[model samples]
Target: MADPRSQVEHEEEDGASAGELLIEACRRNNTDLLADVISSCGGEEKAAEVLNNTKTVLGNYIYHEAALRGNYEVIDMLLDQEGFECDPINTREGDTPLHSAIRFINSLPPTPPSPDNEPSAAYNLISMMLEAGSDASIRNKANLTAVQLLDPRNVELKRLFQEAAEEAEREREIAGLEAEEHEEEALEDDYAGSGSDSDFDPEEFKRQQEEKKKELAELKAAKAEA
Candidate 1:
C-alpha cells in the first residue's frame, strides 16, 4: 500500500479517487465537482466511508489531507456529517488536524504571502473546527492546548487564536445570560397571566422585593461608611 501522504498527494495530482478528488475540489473551491462527487457517492455516506474507515495502510483519513491543505469546505462537509471526528490527533505526533493547520501557518517562510496577510484562512478554519466541537482545552502530548499550538514567533497567529478563544468564551457567556433572562421572563409572564392577586397577593410580592432592595441599599451604605 502507498504511504498515506503519497496516496493523497498522488490522487490529488491525478484527480482520481473520491477522497483525493474531494480534497482537490475543496482546495480549488470547486463546488461543482464537489456536488457531482457528492451526488455519485450518495451524499455524505460515501464521504464518511472514506473519512471514518478508509486509511492508508498506515491509518489516516483522506479528510486529514483536506485539512492539511486548508480546505474549509471539506472540513465543513466532514463535520456536518454525524459523528465525524473533528479532533483526530495524528498517530505520528498526537496532533489534531487543527494542530497540523496551525503548525503549517507558523512554519511558513516570510515571502509575498506573509503571516500578516489580512483575515487569515487558518483563523477561519480554526473557528470552524471550534464551532464543530473541537475542544480548546485538550492538551496535546506536549501538554499544550490547541491555542498554544501557535508559534511563539508568530505574535499575529497567537493573537488570532487568543481572539478566537475570547470570542468563543464571550459567545458562551452571552448564550448563558440569554437563557437565564428567557427563563426569568417566562416565569414573570406565567405568574402575571395565571396567578391571581387574590390567590397570590401582589402586595405581598411588592413588599418582599421592597424589603430585599432596602436590605441591599443598607449593605452598600454600611460598606461605604466603613
Candidate 2:
C-alpha cells in the first residue's frame, strides 16, 4: 500500500485547496502541512477564520476531525490559532470537538500499564482539550455531556473529567461573585455621587460637627478656669 504520508506530501505539492489540506493534515496528524495551510491563509488572523470555516461534508470541523483521530499535535496547533474556537459543534449530533475526543477514546482498548507510570496518551489529549476551555457540560444531541460519554470502566479518565468540571464550576462561581461585588460597589458609588443616601442629612451632619466643636470649646474653657 502506498504510504499515506507520501500521499499527503503529494497533495500538498499538487497545490490542494486550503480546506482540503487542512482536513488531510488533521486526519494524518501532519503538523507541518497544517502550518503550511495556516500560512497560506495569509496570517494568524485570517488563519482562524479559515480553520473554523473548514469542515467536512459530514459537518465536522477540522478540530472535530483532529479530535476524532486523536491527532494531539494537530489539535494543539489548531488551538493556538488566533481566535480558534474550542467548542465548535458538529452538525449531526451537536457534538463539540471534546465530544469527538471522548468518542475516539471510547473506541480504544484499555491502555496497558505503562512502565514509567505516565498518563495514557488519551488522557493527556483530553486534558489538553479541557485546559483549552472545552466545556465538559456541553450536551450532544443524545443529551449526553462529554464526561457522560466516557467508558464507565475508565475510572481514571472519569476522575480527570470530574476534577476539571469541578474546577470550571469553581471558576464560574468566583466570576459570579466578583461580578456581584463590582455591581454593589458601583451602586454604592452612584449613591454617593448622587448624594442619595436616605439616612444621611447634610444639616444633621453640620449640627453634629457644631456639637463636637462646642464640647471641645467647653472642655478647654473649664480647663482654663481651673
Candidate 3:
C-alpha cells in the first residue's frame, strides 16, 4: 500500500514524469516509489504515453538508469511490467541496459586481490538482464555485443552471460515452433470447413439423386400401364 499523499506530493510539487520518478527511485534504491508510479499506468502504456512509459527524453529506458546504479530491485519491477523491454538501446551509444552496466564496470577502479569476496554489481546486473531475455548477441552502434564489452579478466561474468543468452535463445526457438504448429492447425481446420461446403455439397446432391429415382419409377409405371 503506497501513500497516496506521497504520489500527490510528488506529482504536484515536483511534477515528476513517470520516467523521472522511476529513475529517481532506482537511484535511491526505492522499489516502493517505483511501484507506485508504474501502477498508475493502465498497463497498456506505450511510447506515445511518454509520461508513463518509463523512458527519458533521449529514449533511455528506466532500466538504463537502474543498470548504472546497480538497482536490481527496480530492474526487477520494470521487467515485470506488461510491455517492459529489457534490451532497449539508448541512442547515445546504442547501448542496452547490459551495455550500460558494462560501461559502468569498465569505469570502476581496479579490483583488489580478494575480488571474489566483493562480487561485482555489474556482474549481477548482466546476469539479470540476460535472464530477462536481453539478446546477448545484439551489437551496439559500435558493433559490440554485451559479451564483447566484458572485462576480459571477469571470466565468471562472461560465462554466466553466455549461458543465460543461450538459454533465452532456446526458449525463443521453442516458442516459435509452437506458434507455427498452432497456425498450421488453424489453417487446416479452416480449409476443412471451406472444402466440405464447396467440394461435397452433400444436401443438394442427395436431393438431385432422389428426384432422378422418382422420375425413373414413374416411367416404369407408365410402361406397365400401357
Task: List lDDT for all candidates, in order.
Answer: 0.61, 0.79, 0.65
**RMSD to true structure for each model, in Å:** 9.9, 15.0, 18.5
Candidate 3 local lDDT, 125-206, one digit each (tens):
7766776767778899999987798888877687787667655655565566556556655755676677754565556655
> Which residue runs of candidate 3 sit more than 4 Å off their true CA positions?
1-14, 42-52, 110-120, 168-226
**Error in Å for residue 159 of model 2:** 0.9
- 2 or 3: which has the higher lDDT? 2
> Residue 112 in model 1: shift from native, Å?
7.7
* Candidate No. with top TM-score: 2
RMSD of 1: 9.9
For model 1, the local distance difference test gives: 0.61
Measure candidate 3: CA RMSD: 18.5
lDDT of 2 by residue, 119-182 (tens): 8998899999999888899999999999899899988789899888767665665566556556
* Pairwise TM-score winner, candidates 1 and 2: 2
Global lDDT of model 3:
0.65
Backbone clashes per model, in order?
Answer: 0, 0, 0
TM-scores of all models?
A: 0.57, 0.78, 0.61
Q: Which ten residues in a row have the lowest lDDT in candidate 1?
A: 1-10
Query: What is the model-wide C-alpha lDDT for candidate 2?
Result: 0.79
